[model samples]
Target: MRAISTSGSGLVDVDVPEPQLRPHDLLVQVEAVSVNPVDVKIAASAGDERRILGFDAAGTVVRAGPEVTGFTVGDEVYYSGDVTRQGADAELHAVDARIAGHKPGNLSMAEAAAVPLTTITAWESLFTHFGADAGTTGTLLVVGAPGGVGSMLVQLAKQLTSLRVIGTASRPETRERVLALGGDATVDHRSLAASVKDVAPDGVDFLFSPFSEGNIETYAEIVKPFGHVVAIDDHHVDVFPLKSKSIAWHWELMFTHAIYQTPDMASQGRLLDETARLLDEGRLRTTLGTEIADFSAAGLRRAHELVADGKAVGKVVVTR
Candidate 1:
């Protein structure tokens, strides 16, 4: 099987053996894959071992494990595979069926590939951590609203909840992109506190921070008393300031369920199925901003470079 992998010299194209399928796995012929910040981070720490380096993928199932019930051969699916295992960057890959979902009927393979990672992250952050639902009503602020997860987060919040969505973007184009994704309003992140206050005077009920390093103070000021703050970054933050207002801080990582083989791991598959239905119904849309027509090592490297630069407006996908 032909695949791209991370070597000490950097991303390289290699021919590796087909992945061995587990009892609950689905052998998929990968058609498209998306690049995320995690991919860049892993590649940076690459060792002499050649490790496959992709997470989000869309493809067709060629074989299903005997225990699998949700899908079978020939079904198109999309998923963010478990990080602990070899990834989906190959001509053929194996993924646990419990964590994969049927691809949205209306989406192309490339578009579907762009969704899983960001959708899972945003969904888990907003619903699992913040406890938001269709009945939930309040002001929710997204700090990095034009990036991949932020774009999906803004859309999911607007589509599934009664909350008022406020997105923060520093550039004119990015602000416009956020508004188009269903944000009620957009504020410049350069002056986060002031800009947010200008639109949400009473302070927001929830804060979604994709980059939470130096913005803790601004978050402390912008979030209301008893509000919730959900972050996905790895940077250390001092939560002491939020103590005065009794603000609850949470960290959401979409891979936790898969990594631990949690009892509710199947919930991610169901979540993706629901998201696919919404997409097919036109209630939501794909965030694929850039598509690399090539699916080889060179093209994958270019996709990684774009995401690592931190300026991409939405998801970057590499397709066959």
Candidate 2:
């Protein structure tokens, strides 16, 4: 099988053996994949043993494990594969069926590929970590709201909950994109505290920080007393400041269920299934901002570069 693997901070084409499937796995023929910040990080940290670096994939099931019940051969699916194992950068890939979902019929393969990882991250951040539901009513301030996860987060919060959604974006174009994705308002992230306070005078009830490194103080100030903060980035942030206001701090990682083989691992599949239905119903939409024409080493590298530059408005996808 042909694939792209990380090689000394870059990607290179390689011919590797086809992936072996486990008892609950699905053998998928790769159709499209999306690039995320994690892909860039893993590529830069590549060791002596080269590793394939893709997670968001939309593909067709060629074979399903005997234990699989949710899907079968010829099923089109989308998923973010487990980071503990090989990824979906190859022509054919193996993924656990419990973590995969049926692709939204209205979406193209590239568009479907752009949704899984970001959707999972945003969904878990809002519902799983923050414990929000349709009846939940409060203000949600989303930091970095024009990125892949943020784009989906704003939409889901607006569509599923009664919360007022406010997103942060520095540039005019990005702020417009956030508003287009259903954010009630947009604030400049450059002057975050003041901007957020201008729109949410009483302070927000919840804060979602995709970039949490240096904004702890701002978060403490903007979030109201007894408010909640959910972060997804891996920065060493001290949350003690939030303790004074009884603010609860939580972390969300989409890979947790698959990495630990959690009891509710299949819940991710169900979440994605619901996301697909929303997409098909036109309540939600794909965030595919850029699409590479083909799944070549060069195209993958370009996609990685776009994501690493940190300026792309939404998700960047590469189609096979």
> By lDDT, who's the top model here?
1
lDDT of 1 by residue, 115-144 (tens): 999999999988999999999999999988
lDDT (0-100) at residue 41 of candidate 1? 90
Off by over 4 Å in 2: none
Alpha-carbon RMSD, each predicted model: 0.9, 0.9
Off by over 4 Å in 1: none
Q: lDDT score, residue 36, model 2?
A: 92
Model 1 RMSD in angstroms: 0.9
Report, for every candidate in turn, its global Cα lDDT versus the true structure.
Answer: 0.93, 0.92
Q: Name the lDDT value of residue 86 in candidate 1.
A: 93
Candidate 2: what lDDT? 0.92
Query: What's model 1's lDDT at 261?
Result: 97
